[model samples]
Target: MTGFVIRQLGPADAAAYREIRLEGLERHPEAFGSTYEAEAALSPEEFVRRVVEVPTFAAERDGRLLGLVGLARESGVKRRHRGTLIRMYVRPEARGSGAADALVEAVLDHARSEGLDAVLLAVITEAEPARRLYERHGFKVYGVEPGALRIGDRAYDDELRIRFL
Candidate 1:
């Protein structure tokens, strides 16, 4: 953790972001809704657009992008007080290195700075480590969404978690 640095990612980081993200989608299909086939076809320009449009953060160690997280605020006036945490992933080699914690902390810090009232996230129910990680950061389980994501013939449940800031 001491050697890893978390920072905001921009268009310049499109390549690294794409690599890490594709890895997540491919290596753990059930953990994410997006499929590798869909993401792999996207052009570099699309990745650049994502970096420019989304508020993304990354944990880097020795020039390697190990973890990533994205935060998005609701657009509707009624839901503007809430933010969504999305696409959190840490390279397998970096797991248990506190990279996920650092990325989550960065998101929470940003949420506070933006005056968000709460932060929400949905994780696969089978992802025990991720569920525990969120719990350690004050995120509480609100509900379980059945059949939240389906890959081929398999359906995965998602647990909705929220933290009131």
Candidate 2:
């Protein structure tokens, strides 16, 4: 497939997006802090509501979801100018095909439209590709949270990144 067709996610895409998310968690449990079981147990309504709240985008190729990305605005009044990039996942088979890049850009565009001053994200230290992707997009590692997520017997370090829009 050529570049994936990227589109803003709507309420109707909740299930498809959820499936991609679960697949990502299953394939790379160490990359993300979330688990497949944890996401699957959430009701569809919850998924839809979450999608509605955050600006989400999906990449599709040949009718299959290739990637998804979303951002959540900070809740506190003083921190409302900031937003965090979350739920960024690309199908393992679709890596380097531009799907993930498109999804990330779409979400970042949404954040810019919302007048966000900066965006933040936590990338697992060992995920070199992921870290490089963010760096390519002008994100710099501000700090690292040691032992961020405990997955089974081991712990993963997370690097905090920030990009000013």
Candidate 3:
């Protein structure tokens, strides 16, 4: 595979973004709060609005989107200094290609550019590779939320991690 570049996603990328996002939610139900069925029911305009509103970034290779991640800033008066990293996923075929790493760095870079004091994210306790990636990026586990996600009969815990800028 050729090299991939990470860049901010926009409204124009709504369709592609929706495709990969749905794939992630379907393939890894415990990894996200939103369900594939719920997102699949959303209108195209909704996807467009999401890309327009959220600070999303994608890994694109040869005109095809391989992975994506998003950052959401805290809105409260006292919490405005921080942002949360959300919806991080990479295509299975793109694993080990540095797509995940690049996507993460892009979000941190965006956070820094926005003058945020810190960035936070939650990874499922069982997702070791993902946890290692965040730890390598200087994120430390602050806490763990038990039964953070319930899908079917299974409960998944999430490790809350944060990186100070």
Candidate 4:
């Protein structure tokens, strides 16, 4: 994690954010719900709006953006006690170097600071490394959503995990 900086992203980071995000969706279509084609069509202004609206954290090293993770809280009063962890991605070169760890920790820290009761996330059932990462951070699988995502003619299941703050 040395030389890596984990911080909240702003509007100025939209281009970099969009690049990394699209990379993730493109490189691993089965891992995310969003399609690369869908996101690629979005304008820079939309990314800027996302930067301002979502609580997203980015990992940077040597002035280059390496990864991103987003935290979203529920708007309903009854669901306000929880938040969702979304869009976690790290460049392949940065994997196992603690960049993913840093990004997730940043989200967990932010959740605690916001007084949220818990944070929930969904991982593709086949992604063992990601599941292990979340488990090591105290997340427990509560359920599995079979056929949660359908891409083309294939179906993918998602494991739902949650960690109480």
TM-scores of the candidates in the order shown = 0.97, 0.95, 0.98, 0.97
Model 2 clashing residue pairs (backbone): none
Question: Which candidate should be chosen as best, given lDDT against the real structure?
Answer: 3
| TM-score result, candidate 2 | 0.95
Q: Lowest-scoring 10 consecutive residues by lDDT in candidate 3?
A: 1-10
lDDT scores in order: 0.94, 0.87, 0.95, 0.94
- Write one digit per residue (lDDT tens) for candidate 4, span 1-165: 468899999999999999999999999999998999999999999999998888999999987888899999988999989999999999998898898998999999999999999999999999999999999999999999999999989999999999999
Local accuracy of candidate 2 as per-residue lDDT tens digits, 1-165: 575798888889889988888888898888777799999899999889978988788888877888888898999999999999998888878887877777778877888999998999999999999999999888989999999989878999999999999
Question: Which digits, one per residue and each the tens of the lDDT, describe model 3 over residues 1-165?
Answer: 449999999988999999999999999999999999999999999999999988999999988899999999999999999999999999998998999999999999999999998999999999999999999899999999999999989999999999999
Please give, for residues 52-146, the per-residue lDDT of candidate 1 as tens digits: 87789999999999999999899999998999999899998899999999999999999999999999999999999999999999999999999
Between candidates 3 and 4, the lDDT winner: 3
Give the range where candidate 1 is weakest over 10 consecutive residues by summed lDDT. 1-10
List the pairs of residues colliding in candidate 1: none
TM-score of 1: 0.97
Better of 2 and 3 by lDDT: 3
Off by over 4 Å in 1: none
